[model samples]
Target: MRARDLLTPFPTVTPGTSVIDAARLLADHDLPGLIVVDDEGLPASILPGTQVLRLAVPRYCQDDPALARVVDEAHADALLSSLAGRAVRDVLPGRPRELPVTDPDATALEMAALMARTHSPLVAVVDERRLLGAVTLKVLLDGLLAQ
Candidate 1:
């Protein structure tokens, strides 16, 4: 099957979206990540949920799993205070990795390989410069297992 066949509508955020807001969307939808769109609505980058969590948690807590457990939910919320006015772009480390983009006609296997190589949880299926949708890891796995 083609990548288009496995595509599903997914959440997207612009570069200027608040980091806290993005994190809330990720948590509410249990999304692995969000596609970051450019001014033309083309895929620009992928913001993995892990990156948001990295910003929420303290460095010491990240270093020690035990310390993370000690942080109560309220404290955890407090930890995100630093990200209050930060934009999604600010959370990205260094240069953003190239978005994993695929043609709608590409095979599911091809899409899977691209995602694997890029270490991305989703692939944006685009036709020319327009984004059609995304092929998520869960959808890709289901498609492969069904075959």
Candidate 2:
């Protein structure tokens, strides 16, 4: 099976978009995150919800005390209060690693191996360097269950 066979199609976001806007999209669509795409329509990274929460918190990284120092030791607590008030880009994890590509001709075992090696729940399906969609655990499992 290929990624297109099981991958769900979700909206894509561009780089430098406000984290607040991304969070709104997640809430409106009831999605986990948005796929950051480049101009040529390639997957760039993911902006997941939990990352947004982290950004909203007020903490001074021991090495980087800039935020803490700016807020002053007294006002730091007030500034670092809530995730709801913050932007997604501030707290999102580093981008997810890209998965290797394989043709639909590849065996199911080959797909499984790639997934395990990359530790990815999904892999992008490509043909001649074009992304068609994704193949995920749910899609693969559904195929097996049907058989």
Candidate 3:
């Protein structure tokens, strides 16, 4: 079966939303990332949790050489402090190359190749003109196991 058979639709987010709000959305949905949408409602980016972690570093420790030296001594506190006030957008990486999407007709091998190339755990399932949902490695594995 195609990935769409197991796909689940989730709420989307806009790019302009602050990282703080995005974090709240993630927490509410218990998601690791969100499929960011553009004004036209097209997939734009994937904002992952690691991006938030990087932004949580204290500016003093991140920027000042003297402070950077002390960070080795007070690393834990500095890191925690950095995360307290930061926004999510401040840390997210530039969009990585995404996987090639396919319609309901795509075969499992096609999905596997796209994942292999992009190292993506999930492939965004799309029709000729619209997005549907994502197909994850877990979905693929589970389907195989069920057979």
Estimate the TM-score of every prediction.
Answer: 0.88, 0.54, 0.65
What is the overall TM-score of model 1 with all chains considered together?
A: 0.88
Candidate 3 structure quality by residue, lDDT tens digits, 80-140 = 4644454444555677766345676677778888767765556667776677877766776
Provide the overall lDDT of each model, using Cα atoms, as 2-decimal numbers: 0.85, 0.59, 0.65
Off by over 4 Å in 3: 57-92
Question: Which has the greatest lDDT?
Answer: 1
The residue ranges of model 1 lying beyond 4 angstroms of the native Cα positions read: 69-73
Choose the strongest candidate by TM-score. 1
- Using lDDT as the measure, name the better of candidate 1 and candidate 2: 1
Residue by residue across 14-127, what tens digits does model 2's lDDT show? 665666677678689766445666678776655444444346554454447665466656555543355444444445456546444556565667777876776655555666
Q: Candidate 1 at residue 142, lDDT?
A: 92
Clashes of each: 0, 4, 1
Worst 10 residues of 3 by lDDT: 80-89
Residue 86 miss distance in model 3 (angstroms): 6.9
Could you arrange the candidates by TM-score from highest to lowest? 1, 3, 2
Question: Which residue pairs collide in model 1, if any?
Answer: none
